[model samples]
Target: MGIHLHKLALVGAIALGAFGLAACGSGSSDSEGGATGVENPTPVGGSWEKGNFLPVSTFTDRCVSPRSGTDPITGSAYADVLGTRQDENNWLRSMSNELYLWYDEIEDKDPARFDSSLTYFEELRTFALTPSGREKDRFHFTEPTNEWLSQSESGIYIGYGVQWALISSEPPRKALVAYLDQEDSSLPDAITRGAEVISVDGVDLANGSDVDTLNEGMWPAKSGESHEFKILPLGASDPVTVTLVSAEVESDPVQHVKVETTDSDRKVGYMLFNDHIAKAEGELIDAITELESEGIDDLILDLRYNGGGYLDIAAELAYMIAGDNSVGQSFEHMQFNDQHPEINPVTGAPLDPTPFHTSALGLADDSLKGYPLPTLNLPRLFVLTSGNTCSASEAIINGLRGVDVEVIQIGETTCGKPYGFYPLDNCGTTYFTIQFSGANAKGFGEYSDGFVPNGPFGTEADLPGCEVDDDFDHLLGDVNEARFAAALNYIEGGDCGDVAVKAFAEFGTSNRLLESNVSVPKEISRSNRIMVR
Candidate 1:
């Protein structure tokens, strides 16, 4: 399974002084009786508000509690105290207000879903806040606070260090290894990309009855668990059995960076930018610096598998690519809920647009701070994308186009996410709720269905590019690979041959065939939601 590190904006600095008085007061005693003589009380954190307080309950007790109650202060019966608690902390407080986008309809739909017994994260799932009507707002979720914090600091995850693609979903349910992390030494040499799965843990993948077992083996719930797989390498006739142990693996976001001359003798700088984490900022700078020295004529940004990360990094990359053209332009304009439309929720100030940043941000050390960014200064950009290209990656495309740079999008449609948030930690879970939507300088951010390749006739949001399917037959960086070849062909005023078009057509038609027969591993297929720091 692939490891994903979500892009999260750091929480805005809290005014400790505001909570100083609240912390000094004793917490309200239980209504039933005086406090028991328990010596070690749980350490308290954050501000104490009477409405936010509730009797803590164990897991079993919490599930059986009443769904609604009267607030002592307001003397009003409420169905959603969990919702109220979230409203107090969520950047977009309007979600809890009477005028929320779906307020009337959702209240009539299923009010029970908002009960306190249900978690705040679960209640957010019931809201419809996205303009796209596709429920793009539903990507909000939570992860273990420790896990979220650790992965944000260091891109490490517990997994088998392999990415899988469901190539065929007929009765046999075939899956192919997409890529293996080169940084993980624990992965065996036999488990290479393009290897075909025969069976998992003695359960025949060809047998429909064992589908559940196959999925469990492929995506184990915990690390150190072992799974044996029968696999066939690219040209092997006989399947070999290998046991893989899931372990902690570090992901390198920039997998490949190089310069290659095309058939037309144009030097094309290629970069496989997988994510927008802090580490990626320095790596991208290094890649661009090298490409600048070599004097490349064009750039191909491969974001085929990038999920997303920090917004600041996306702004930096746009500035690096567009150079002086992006200096005075808005990279993205964040739009909050209607209630706080004119204010920045995180900072409590008037909405300030984020411009193309010329320097690195949020790095632990002062190195690279205010350092001049390198630029290719090209009038056009070639961005390679897939269904996996999303969030901050999409921001790069929108941000560049905002500055009027020609962005030629290659490959399939992007994941189509324009919303972002600052992850909030409550209890032991880190919650991610969509707090703001973003637009480019042209005021266009409505492509929630995703940006498709522009073909002969182009849509308003489309770019001049071809929709080429991923070519697993050839390695990603190879010049003959379908998507890269299409980009090169377009650049040289050539057309993709009939054979390539036919192949892509077949691939698109067989969407069900490629769809996973079982659930995809969460680490590999996690939703692309940007968390603002």
Candidate 2:
């Protein structure tokens, strides 16, 4: 979606002819780019220097793999020209320097030191640390246009219909099938939620040294790639090995919707929302409408595995949850670099606070627009979260908190990502660079360290909630799931439970707790706080 040319903005096409880049026609990059050599090798950024720079337009559309004719996605003419590693890298350098939120903090390293555009683009970010000493700009990265379009637009990916939960990534590791794509009917019956991954192929996952084989088997590069997995099925005494072939798995973002009548007679609505993709706009609306009909006493949104996609979707979700309390309130406001303080450098529009859109966004189909969204009008809400609850997921908590809507969080700390950018494509490669940081109403956006459960409530980034570990023993949205149960307990008791945080040393890692609760596939796991321009 390179900051998605869905709108197909012509970023000053005259510059292409001025620099004479159009003559370099139809050439493509064969380099499996990294800090590596190239197929069509040329001097890296040949004559470029560290401090000196050019207009961003000078190298725009100059691609290592330039396309011709019409683009199928946007129906716009392809504006690419064959270019070298230098042109591609230079464009990235100039683009980052001109529009990046922390452009001054970036080191203007010589592009000549980088061999491919990918390697050079990778290093062109501010190496600054947040107040918590965490990496400030963890969102800068790129993706192939083909893969990005399919997954971002349709939530499609090539895998075993499994969403892994990595309790420990290092050796003597432990992994579990945290969630499964309900859309995948071909998945083996034993590969249910809470199933532990003992090994992949013939290699011992707990103590094996061969990293490449394990990665390929678990997350195959393409479809029809079959691999053997030794799994310890949930509630089973013995482990069994099963062969799973990777296929195109489309995720059901909003699933497990039901109205639960608690013991105390409160009808609580629950849902397991995983992604914030385009289709979620309609699915969420449908879910909310369904929940409203049941007269739910309270709502618990399970967002533990939601890494985030579209900001508009988050804003819509906020509006649906808060209802009349959100009138005249801003969902989030954008803050750009010092150079473009008053205007969006990319869209060339006035800088403004993005309000909570009451109507459907029509992401999947244009005909779906103009319909008023159904609301719950609940005074308070509950969100089930974890380390994978990031970006737009975190925005929901922050935006709701900004409006004084009580958000009782249950689970570990949420992944902090308040920054967002438009995925921009240049010469076939989609680049995701942080261009803005968003603050909800009351202007509180500095949650780079993440919101914590049971954290000091007085702090802008802290919230009132219980600290509970993710329970893989039960499926998400189940009343017995650790986080969901904690939410239910809080509704009845209004106090945190005595659930002491525990670690799994039995899984083999010397480290007790998981590095991340939701295992992210590298293919689709980029900084997901995507702002569609």
Quantify all predictions' global Cα lDDT against the true fold: 0.59, 0.74
Backbone steric clashes in candidate 1, count = 7
- For residues 1-533, write the lDDT of model 2, one tens digit per residue: 23243322423221220100011111236342322233554433347777776776767765565677786556779776556667777877888887789989888977656767777776888888888777788666677666777777768888877876666676667778878867345677789888888888888877787766777777676799989999999889899989998888787789899988878999999998888888788899999999999999899999887878889889999999999999789999999888877877777778888788899867876777878999999889999877778888888998888888999888767778898887777777777788899999989998887888888755777778877877778767778777777888888889755544332211101111223322443234322787766
Per-residue lDDT of 147 in model 1:
65
Candidate 1 local lDDT, 96-130, one digit each (tens)? 22112222333221222232312433453445544
Stretches of candidate 2 off by over 4 Å are 1-3, 6-50, 499-519, 522-527
Among all windows of ten consecutive residues in candidate 2, which has the lowest summed lDDT? 17-26
Candidate 2 backbone overlaps, count = 7
RMSD (Å) per prediction: 10.1, 6.5
After superposing candidate 1 on the true structure, give the runs of residues whose Cα lies further than 4 Å from its correct spot. Answer: 1-120, 125-133, 168-170, 183-186, 364-366, 455-459, 494-531
Candidate closest to the true structure, highest TM-score: 2
State every prediction's TM-score relative to the real structure.
Answer: 0.76, 0.89
TM-score of 1: 0.76
